[model samples]
Structure formats: C-alpha cells, structure tokens
Target: MSSPATTPTAARTPRKAALASWIGSALEYYDFAVYGTAAALVLNHLFFPTETSPGAAILFAMGTVGVAYVVRPLGALVMGPLADRFGRKFVLMLTLFMIGGATFAVGCLPTYDQVGMLAPALLVLCRVVQGLSAAGEQASAISMSLEHADEDRRAYTTSWTLQGTQFGTLLATAVFIPFTLLPEEALFSWGWRVPFWLSAVVVVVAYLIRRHLEEPPAFQEARHEVPAGQPVSPLSVLLRHHRAAVARIAAAAMINTVNVVFTVWSLSFATSVVGLDRATMLWVSVLANAVALFVIPAVALLADRVGRKPVFLAGVLGPAVMMYPYLAAVHAGNWPLIFLFGAIMSGCLYSMANSIWPSFYAEMLPLPVRVTGLALGTQIGFAVSGGFAPVLASAVAGPAGDNWLGVAVFVTIACLISGGAALTATETAQKSLDEIDALHSSRTEAAELQALGTGQEPAAGRGAEEPAASGAGR
Candidate 1:
C-alpha cells in the first residue's frame, strides 16, 4: 500500500508537528479567548442598549460568548469527520483561515448606536463561524501531535497545544490591559477594538507556519489500510462503537467550566460586582495564564512518568477546594489575596488537568475515530457547561451585587463531576499506539488493518500483562 513517492514524507517529524500544533492553538484561542474579555467589558454596552439593565446586558453579552459554544457541537459534527477522513493538515489550515476572517470581522462590526439590533445579530453570526473553526482546531491538532509522538513522550508533546492556550490568554489580556487605561470615552469608543484587529496579524503568522506541516504517519497508514471502494466512515464507526468513550470524555470535559468561571465569569464578577479595579482583574488573567504557560508543561512531564489520572484527579479536587477562597478574595477586594488565590487556582492546579487531557482523551480512541471522538465529546460537554457558565454566573450573582457562595458552589460541583468521570478511564501513559488501539478494537482487527499498510507489529491486545502506569485500573 505504500507509494514510493509518499512514504518518506508521510510521517511528520514530531518536533515539527508539536511546534505547529502549539502556534496554531495559540492563534485560534487568541481569537477565541479575547471574546470573553470583550463580553465582560465592552460588548454589553456597544451591542446591547443602555435601556437594558447593566446586569441583563452583561448576561446578554455573555450569552453571545456562549453562542459559539452552543454551536460548537454542531461544528464538531461537521469538521471532526472531515479531519478524520480527509487529513488533519487540511482541516487545520481551513479553521485557521475561517477563525482569522471571523475575528477580523468582529473588529469591523457597528455598535448598537450605529446599527441597532443588527450589530448583535452580526456578532452572533461571526461567533458561529468561530465556534465552527474551534470545534476542529483542537481535535485535529491533538490527534496530529499525539500520533507523531513516541509512546513515552505523547503526553508531554501534546501538552504544548494547551501551553499555546496559556500564551493566547496572556496575549489577549496583555492587549486588553493597556486599552482599559484609556479615558472612559475613548475606551468605550475605539480602545476595545484594537485586540480584535490584531487577530489578522496573528492569523497570517500562524498560516505561514502551519502550511508547511505534514500529516501524521499513522493516519496516513490507517487511510491506506482500507480496501479500495470501501473507505470507512469515522462518524459511523464512532457512533456505533465508541458511545461509552464519548460519554466518559464528556463528563471529564466538564473541567472546562472551572476554566470558564475563572477566566470569564470571575473577571466580570470581580470588576462589575465587587468593584475591584478592571486593571486588577485583567492582571489576574495575565498572571494566571503566565504561570500556566510554565506550569502546564511541567505537569504534562509528570503525567508522562506517573500517569494521567492521578494528576488529572488532583487538578480536579484542588480547584474544588480552592474556588471558594478565590471567589471570597475577590469579594473582599483584597488585591494581594485575589492575585495569590487566582494564581494558585487557575495557574497551577488547573494547569495539571489542562495539560494532560489532550493525551488522556486522545489515546482512549483508535486512530480512525480519534479526532471526531475528541472533538464531539469535549464540544458537547463544553457547550452545556462552559458555554452556559458565564451567563449563569452573571445571573446567580444577581443584578447588583456579588454572590460568591452561589458561584463557588457551581464551580465545585463541576470539578467533582470531572474528577469522578476521569476515574473510569484506563491509564494510557505507557501504552503504544497499537496497544491503545486494541483496547477499543479487537486485536485481530487492529493487526489486520495495520498489516494492510504499515506492516507494524500485531497488537498483543489491550489486556496483555505488563507493568501498569500509576493509577491504572482505578
């Protein structure tokens, strides 16, 4: 099945794949995460009328932020299968351009004063495209990176994608902080649009970097393994065989709610409700994300040796305990306490789960359905929890004041859900590609498929006796 022309180029270099994944994710999320800051601070007034109460406007704006997540599952449905079938590099470039165009368009939209209801309508439409772009970005990037990695280093390699996320957040808030210091008149009028416009620059930078990357060898081998005129459908296979994986992943994915609460909702709460200075809240994002850029990679290295479950579970429980104090610090308007607690909760503890989930979730799936499975399961959970969290948090805090108790309880429950769900998965840190693939497919099936193309070793099956990674069989 190997064509002489393609074999040498088929397997991407792990370093190239990982670096491309990192920059691509950083650019996509820079576009994605900046919307949260805008929703909390700018969009409420520019897109929603002053006639709406401030709290209601904030809720409406946050709802627009959620709109992308609401439509994300739909995006996964469309984009996931394409990546699975067509190839990861194609979908990766496609989303890069799509999100770039959408983010730039957001900078061009007319405010409520200029265009009335049409402004928010246009904003939602742009968010929809962005939602679609994001749906495929992570799944494809993670799948590509994970496949390229050697077994011992997969968790560490894939985590660079999420490290890119921290960089994206850092850049978004870094751009936002200076704008917030502008005179209120200018800040509300033009200051806020600068970051949105800068998305175009990041887009060009990412596209130039990403276009040169190759598809992973395993995906190419898997594609070649199928018989002529009988190409397997990734979606059909996923729905029929991996429903349990989907469910487990969705539950584990709820950890995103903690992130949403910390990054978007908490920032809004501290500034709007507790009257903490806007600059101070932005610094929380800056510091936490800055810390995470370092912390996530370190945790990923640890997960590589010890296994993902313990690190992921620790990430879950740490935040469940810490959310209360973090919110309390915000309410007290104690700047030092807010800074300290925010760094601990979001920067350090949360980074552990954030880094590991890329490999933890990806390895559970077979090569054929991995991209689709990762995309759909995570997007569905995110649609319900993270998408709704900001709107729900604004509502729980009431129109006029802080409701730290209600908000804290909401985050804690989400953490517990993610932690409990993670326990159900088998630890995958030490497993090879074929061994991991055999966990879901029959051993004979895995070998027969691989033999048709790559001619690698037949799987010994997922049940083979061997030394277990820490927290295996939990």
Candidate 2:
C-alpha cells in the first residue's frame, strides 16, 4: 500500500482546482472579449486613422483581432511541451501574467494622433502577446482539471473551466455598456480603456489562486515514472503516434468558427450593415450571454450522462439552424425578433459546444500527449476559421451591404464539418483516465516488460495491449 505521504493532495482539491481554473479562464477571456468589443466599436476610430474610409478602417481593426488567432497556434506549439513536461500550474500562471500585462498595455497605447503609423503597429504587438497567452490558457486548465477529476465526473468538472469563459464574456460586455452610453468623444477618448486596464487587477488575484495549485496525480505519476531509455519529447511522440488524432481534433475544432461568427462578425454586421443601434447590439450580447451562464453548465451535466458527441452535435445543429433566423432578424431591424433569435442562437444553441468542447477536445488524446495535441489541433483550427472568419464574413457582406446570407452559409457549412468530424471520435464519457489513455499506457507497459526482463521491478507498471498504430481506434 502507498504511504500517506504518497497520497496526491492535488487530486483531493478538485472543487478548488475547478474554481481556480474557472476564475483564471474568466479573466483570460474577459481580456479577449474586451479586445473584440473594442475592435468592433472603437478600434477603427481610435488606433487607425479616419483618413481611411470607415469601411476600410473597420476591416483593418477586425483584422487585428484575427492577428491574435493567427499567433495562437504558434503559442500552442511553443507552450504545449512546457506544460506537458513541467506541470500545468506553472504554465497556467505564466500565460495569465502575459495575457493580463499585454491587455493592460493595450489600454496605455497612444492613438494615431499622438503616435502616427506607430500607434496601430504597437496595438498589433500587444494583441499578438495576448493571443499567445490565450493559446495555452484553456488547454492547460482543462488538462489539470481532467487529471484531478473522478473518471465518471470528468465532464461535469471540466465544464466549469468553460463556464468561466461565459462569465468573462458577460463581464466584458457589461463593462462596455455604460461606456457605450458616453458621448462619442468621451467613449472613444477613454471609456474603452477602463475594461482593459481592469484586467491587471484580476490577473493578480487569479495568479495568487493558481500559484498554490499542485500538479494532478495522473501527471505527477507519469512524470515520476520516466521510461528507462532516453526520454522522448511530447512533440515527437505526438507527430509519430497521434497524427491522425490531431487531424481529427483540428477538423472538429472548426466549430470555433461558429463561435467567432456569432460574437464578432454578427455584431459588426448588425451595427454597420443592418444599421442597428450600438447599444441594442451590445444588449443582445449581454442578455444572450447571461442566459448562457445557466445554459452552458446544464448542457454539460447532460453531457456527463449522455456523451460528448451528442451534446456537441446538438450544439452544432441548433446554431446552424438558428443562424438563419437570427441574421434575418438583424436584417429586418426588428428588436423582439433579434433578441429572441439572438438569445437562442447564442445563449442556448452556440453554448452547447462552449460547455462541452473543453472536455470533448481534451479526451480525444491520451494523457501523455494530451496537452500538446489538444492545443495544437484546436488553436490551429481556430486560427484558420475563428481567427480570419470575421474578415471573411465582412467580405461576404459585400459591397452591396447586409448580404449576410453568404456569411450565414459560410458559418453553417463550418458547423457541419466540425460536427461530422466529431461523429468519427470515440464516446469517452464512460471511460476512465487509464482507458481514455491507451497509446501511452501501451508504451508504458512495453517498457515495464523490458524492465522486468532485466530483473528490475517494473518502474512504470504494465498496461493494456498496444494499439497496432497510435491513431488506431480506442
């Protein structure tokens, strides 16, 4: 029997761990959503000069939003190995500080008046850092939460990390409402800066909570039992063994495009093309997200009972269907229809993927390579779809205006692709950590057998029969 000293105190604090993950994720996404809000409402007017047409200026500001997504996959590539090898907690804290500091610096940047061409350039630099910070935040938090959770309860626990994201959106949007009420001069001059500046304070508190966290027992055990031969890097193992799994994950992650469409492009569309009031559009976001606060957790509980795929597919299908009515309402400038369709599309429907993707995406890979695989696949996919999607949606809106039908079709097809890819994945809801982790277990067992032949007690212990290939069906 193991001694009390060997008992994993980290796994014992699942609730605390989940709470910490929730708060940190909330703060991280709050910073992101704040940037998005700024890009939509004020960025064109503030950072970039108005000598450019408003249309061209908005396009450039929106493109800056995509810049972060562009860097996210690179961030994942750089940070995933560190999290996999070092421990999730340290990396989580590092990402938090980087994101918070970068966001705070954004508030401090000069406008084109003071800095000329250099102003937008500086803003892009800060956004790139924020994007890199974001790349690892969700993946690391989910990995730690998953490792600390009970086998049956993993989905429910991991769902909280995503729940935090909804709260962040709510908070970010709420902060902007009062600011939007300001006169155009005041709103652009300083009102938008408050939310970004507040990120620093939240980061300090979240960092304190996260710094105390210990690595989960599963990760600690794997780290404890290094193989007898030369150690392999997680990157090499991921490429050689889990190539197909990563591709599938990236494919399924196309769902992020749907999210970007709802949050970013749709807002820009309603305001610019549809001529909806800025406050009206902002309230739609706040209310829909408020409803989603409850919706996301409930959907996740159901996922724990049913399966990740069904819940996520329902999420994908609902929004794909609703994407039509919601945009139609925006085109009509009908407030009630806009709120009704918008709430369901964003709050109830889109949230299905929001609640479940943390657990669903993480479960696709075995533990040893889980962080890198999840980060690489999801961030890269998000980069291609979510990152540049707003620019695409804007172009699709076309020179004729409010041609949202094209953009709506773009979003629907993306959802169909992600949902179809999800169908090909295993139903991991009922599986244990060890069962979900097949490839690593097989290799460990093979190493243990080799150790036993040398008359050394098996250092890593035995595992299930090895898969014929790393990407073979679980």
Each prediction's RMSD to truth:
5.5, 4.6
- Residue 68 of model 2 has an lDDT of 88
lDDT of 2 at 117: 87
Worst 10 residues of 1 by lDDT: 465-474
The C-alpha lDDT values of all candidates are: 0.82, 0.80
**140-217 per-residue lDDT for model 1 (tens digits):** 999989988877889999999999987887788678778888998998888888899999998888888778887887
Can you list the residue pairs that collide in candidate 1? none
Which candidate has the top score in lDDT?
Answer: 1
Q: Give RMSD (Å) of candidate 2 vs. truth.
A: 4.6
C-alpha lDDT of candidate 1 relative to the true structure:
0.82
